[model samples]
Target: MELQTITIKREDYVSIVEINHPPANTLSSQTITELREAFQILKDDIDTHAIIVTGAGRFFVAGADIKEFTEAFGDYDAAFAMAEAGQALCDEIEQMKKPVIAAINGAALGGGLELSMACHLRLAAEDAVLGLPELNLGLIPAFGGTQRLRKLVDMPTALEMILSSKQVKGKEAAEIGLVQAAVKGDELMDTALTLANSLVAGKSMTSVKRALECVVQGADEALEHGLERERVKFAELFLTDDAKEGITAFVEKRKPDFKHQ
Candidate 1:
């Protein structure tokens, strides 16, 4: 399928979605809408077990297309649509059945960083920069930042990043848990693939999806729903070859070759 604003490719069970708007990859309302549609297509795709999002040129995504905010010039609908696009992208990525990983190669600021946070895992290039700079524009992140930021890191850290609007290096982002790890700029996608493929090798689609749901529902939900969810998922997986292979492989001291059943 052709996407108007982005490029999409599926390599076996791993799908790579790239932002090719060029320059700084500032996301506009149209681009956001297209990204939502692209992700929707990926969600419906059974062949793809994971989705990795990145960007072309020198940026993952610099931020929202500030032109929209300025052009809004007090038009509430403009503001509404801009925020709607950002929020929709975040929500869609979060609830996506297949795990989504953001491979940040360069700058990811404002909504760009929020986009990264919505992913189940994030891998950034060592030279990449990330921050929430909406404050400088006299605005705040409207794309689940206030909520998801605190969830990813601590409140104090999230607040410090948001309130202070200071950009941080990839290693610091990883150290603070904003991202899972930092690799060389050229090694960003390689690291992401290593992790994604490892998950594909260990679990079926059902178990993977359920695990993501459990975590996204948060720690409070984990305490209340985790065990029950895990029990149900485990029982379901038992009927699949994946479970047998997994158990037999463990007892055999060999690798479990998952079938994603």
Candidate 2:
């Protein structure tokens, strides 16, 4: 399928996903639908071991395409559906089996930051800024921002960012655990791909996926529960073709060619 708002490319074990609804790349309803479909396609493809999500140009995504909502929001249900559908798009990335890395190369505000937060890991560029500035617009983050933000960072930090409508730099994002690494602008995609390659070659990607799932799905839970959750996934991995190939390669002390299946 052809997409004007997103670009998809796959080479070897990685898939590069880019949001390209240009001029700030606002998330229009159409863009939301397209994004959901794009994510579904990539997530269903077993050959795609990892995905690197980034924007086409400068900004990752400003937020919801307010211009599209200005007139349609005359009804409350209309507004709710818009937010809910968008949230589902982001939610799919979290549920996907493979790893997803967010290459935050520029501004990632409101829904944009929410999108990045959905990824398994985030790497921000030095110039990247992320925040939930929805309150300033007389609205709060309606697209999983309120929940996901707090889920990612501490409650206090999430509230501080939300209430103040403040934008945080890459350094601040990394320090607060919102992002794992911060690097030069040009290195954002490269860093993400490098991380993806490392996971692809480690012969423990199923373990990595298990760990990510345990933490992301654990909720306000205890370590024992989290460990148990991970244990289940780890055991389940042994049922897949990836487990057979990866474990055999490890026993042979050779590189595993993961099909991500």
Tens digit of per-residue lDDT, candidate 2, span 1-261: 567898899868799989999899888887888888888898667677788888988998888887867766568988888788878988888877788889998999988998888888899998888999889878889888888888788999999999999899999899999999999998778788989888766555666667667877786578888878878887898898888998899899998886655
Off by over 4 Å in 1: 218-222, 238-259
Best prediction by TM-score = 1
Q: How many clashes would you count in candidate 1?
A: 0
Candidate 1: deviation at residue 22, Å? 1.7
User: Candidate 2: lDDT of 198?
Assistant: 83
Q: What tens digits encode model 1's per-residue C-alpha lDDT throughout 82-173?
A: 78778988999989888899999999999899999989899999889999999998999998788889988999998999999989999999
Pairing residues by index, what is the TM-score of model 1? 0.89
Q: What is the Cα-based lDDT of residue 210 in candidate 1?
A: 70
Worst 10 residues of 1 by lDDT: 215-224
